[model samples]
Target: MTTTVRIATPDEVPILNAIRTSVRENHMTLEQMADYGITPEVIANLLRTTGRAFIANVDGVDAGISIADSAEGNIFAMFVLPDYEGLGLGRLLLAHAEAFLHATGVASAWLEAGAGPGIRAHGFYAHLGWQSDGLMPDGQLRFVKSRAALTQIVAGG
Candidate 1:
């Protein structure tokens, strides 16, 4: 029942994509990913540059993933295998990604989610302290977390 999160290796596009495509929510296929310029080479180059990906393993098996765009201060993606759901791997991976962004000096970070509140990720992000930031021009929901906001809230501002 032990879970671990680690920075994904440079060539983990296949593993990362497998976990991504396996999700029923926020579902995306290989072709759809490619259509969005998320090809394997692009992912690899991102890993080598402005993006960082984290893989979560449960009891020694790869079960989930999180990716962040450092330059954009965005949580680009997070996904857990259906078989690995409910074990809190997604939360752990997300915390790790957020920690990475914080370490890199981002005051705020954001991630897009499905349009409806009924989507599991909507609740997940909300539960993790991400504030709803309304919809993107393309209609996706944007959620953000800000260290500065947290500081202001803590100061009763």
Candidate 2:
């Protein structure tokens, strides 16, 4: 029940890959992931760029992961193991991503989610105050949220 989130180091790619591939929705197989340039080296290189990766643990067990890119102002990725779904780890990880963007002086951040009907991510982003701007050419739903407004909400405005 003890939940914690931390900056993920380069050596933890397996943990990242584990949480990522565990998702039944929007999953990429090992080959597919590498095909998309999502290799361990890329993950490490990304962390050295205008982005960061995070790992969330429940009772000391890795359960989720997220990556936020301040340069792109994007929540590049987020995933949680199915068994960890109901524990609110996704929310915690997302907040870390947003905070990373805000702290880097980004005014807003955006992320892509599966646009298909009945996809929980669409509603999840909306429920978190991310406005659905439009559907992207990639057929993913684009969701945006301004850090200023988010700060206000956190401040009890």
lDDT of each structure? 0.84, 0.83
| Weakest 10 consecutive residues of candidate 1 by summed lDDT | 148-157
The TM-score obtained by model 1 is 0.91
Which candidate tops TM-score?
2
* Model 1 root mean square deviation, Cα atoms: 5.1
Stretches of candidate 1 above 4 Å error?
148-157
Q: In candidate 2, what are the lDDT values of residues 3-97, reduced to their tens digit?
A: 87888877887888888888978887778889978887888888887778889989989999889888888999999998889789888888778
Which whole-number lDDT from 0 to 100 does residue 91 have in model 1?
80
Deviation of model 2 at 96, angstroms: 0.7
Query: In candidate 2, how many Å is residue 24 off?
Result: 1.6
Tens digit of per-residue lDDT, candidate 1, span 1-157: 8877778867889999999999989899999999989998988998999888989988999999989887999899999999989998888788778877776678799999976657989889898899999999878999999955322211100
Root-mean-square deviation of every model: 5.1, 3.4
* Candidate 2 CA-lDDT value: 0.83
Q: Worst lDDT window (10 residues) for model 2?
A: 148-157
